[model samples]
Target: MQSSYLLTLLLFAVNAFAVSLPIRIVSWNVRFDADASTRQDGEKPWSTILCGIWSERCRKPHVIELLKNEAANTASPTIIGLQEVLDNQLEDIKGGLGSTWQHIGFGRDDGKKAGEYSPILYNTDALTLVFSEMKWLSPTPDEVSFGWGAGSRRVVTIGVFEHKATGKRFIHANTHLDNVSSEARSEGIKVVASRIKAVREQFGPLGATLTGDFNSEPNQDAYQTLEDMDFLTEVSKSEAVKIRNLDLTYTGFESEAGFSRIDFVWFGPTEQHFYAAQSWEVVNNVVDGVFISDHRLVVADLTAL
Candidate 1:
């Protein structure tokens, strides 16, 4: 009888040690232009025009449904890093997502003067925020202006969280890079790469993940710069060809033949154990059969190192 009890305890211990630490993350640029007009009444005309573009192009109801679907499909992700989300939209998402998900974000565009921002949302039940901060990509971190004229303004949101159950901690960095100028994109990549390196240096290797709509494709030079820095692993490259062949994430308003794979989820090289990286296009609704938001949500599952 004693032998049976000992054997059972041994098995339980082994099972506990062998269990995989699974984390699901979703990155989406919700089209910042959509909420531009929601500012105080009589906001700037430029902001109104931006909001109008968003309303016409972005399907908020469909997006909320997509978020709910992702949460349900994954049984809820520990962390969700989002870009181009305005303050008002974050509130709407909170209402829709219920009290389970907690979020942190700040606007890089106009700062407190205006209310736009990018937010990182996480399941409060699974992870607790340890630290959070927002910083610009410009050489001058204190400035609020568009870092390099890379479309309005941009900023990166960083958060460190501890797994409520296992006590394991990891950092998640989210950002939206310049979409227009190659120089801006290149500079933005360096700034973010430097930030990631600094985090790993302080937190130890393999202790972080970076996700966002970088606005640069896998084959682009900006992405290559990151690869050279050894700061991130483009999940798609490690994934199988069959999986990589899926439709690209960004479709310019109208359905066109060529779409770019600009959205990405990257992990440091130290995180090699987490393999078989993959991405999916969450195509739910279409206008006249044309997709919404020039971009799609890309997700990947990784085995903890």
Candidate 2:
């Protein structure tokens, strides 16, 4: 489906004098770089360069370009949470975003370089890492294991960050709920929320943001359960909030393949927290001709309350 961008940022740009309480957050599930045999019709294998060194058919360059543009507005310090990222793809993103960007979280399978990472990337010039950790979404969260009949191991990357400019701190947690098991998705998010609360008890009272490809819609168990959570405030789904679009976030590569809203960004443990979402937008996933990822990323501006 079609989409638009943030008019708030545009106004910030044109007027230079616009009040900028710019703490921008993004949630995306960049489809894992897969083997050609498994590649679908609308999908392209990832590449690091342009052709001889990089080919036009490659998707990594495009992915990097999309991120670069997203992080372009420096006045708003950006924090990006990405899912389905292989270790190599993470490196490509780091390199593309350059030295000013830094990230946290390790692979879920081995806690090393073995599996996918739902990593949190931020601009170093804007934010300082206070604390971070990665935990499996299983009963044995401290160990590498699967949970609730899930097909594979899943993990949540949690980080506490301080805005260098204002000394404001916020917690950000990122994860991808399992697609194969409804029980896993449902139980896994409770694990995620408990972890965030644990973080808050240790370092909060400060505002917190959770970004992820939940794989479950608002009416579904996972999303609804999280909303039922007293500590968290749903931004993208809240009727009280004026969001630019509640459009489907996952396009499944082809327009006709699949359409759904399974991604979200939230703030908590109470709406009274310092971070109040100001503007929210579901960014267009298509760049030029290729879908940047199977899902459209969500962007939001938060004011420090």
- In candidate 2, where is summed lDDT lowest over 10 consecutive residues? 12-21
* Candidate 2 residue runs with Cα over 4 Å from true position: 1-21, 48-56, 238-246, 256-258
Query: Best candidate per TM-score, number?
Result: 2
Give TM per candidate. Answer: 0.78, 0.88
lDDT of 1 by residue, 111-221 (tens): 552545667898888888878777777776557756665665777778877676655667788988877777777787788777766765675543577888777877786
Highest lDDT scorer: 2
Which runs of model 1 end up more than 4 angstroms from their true locations?
A: 1-19, 33-58, 113-115, 239-245, 256-258, 271-290
All candidates: CA RMSD in angstroms? Answer: 6.7, 9.4
| C-alpha local distance difference test of each model | 0.65, 0.82
Total backbone clashes of model 1? 0
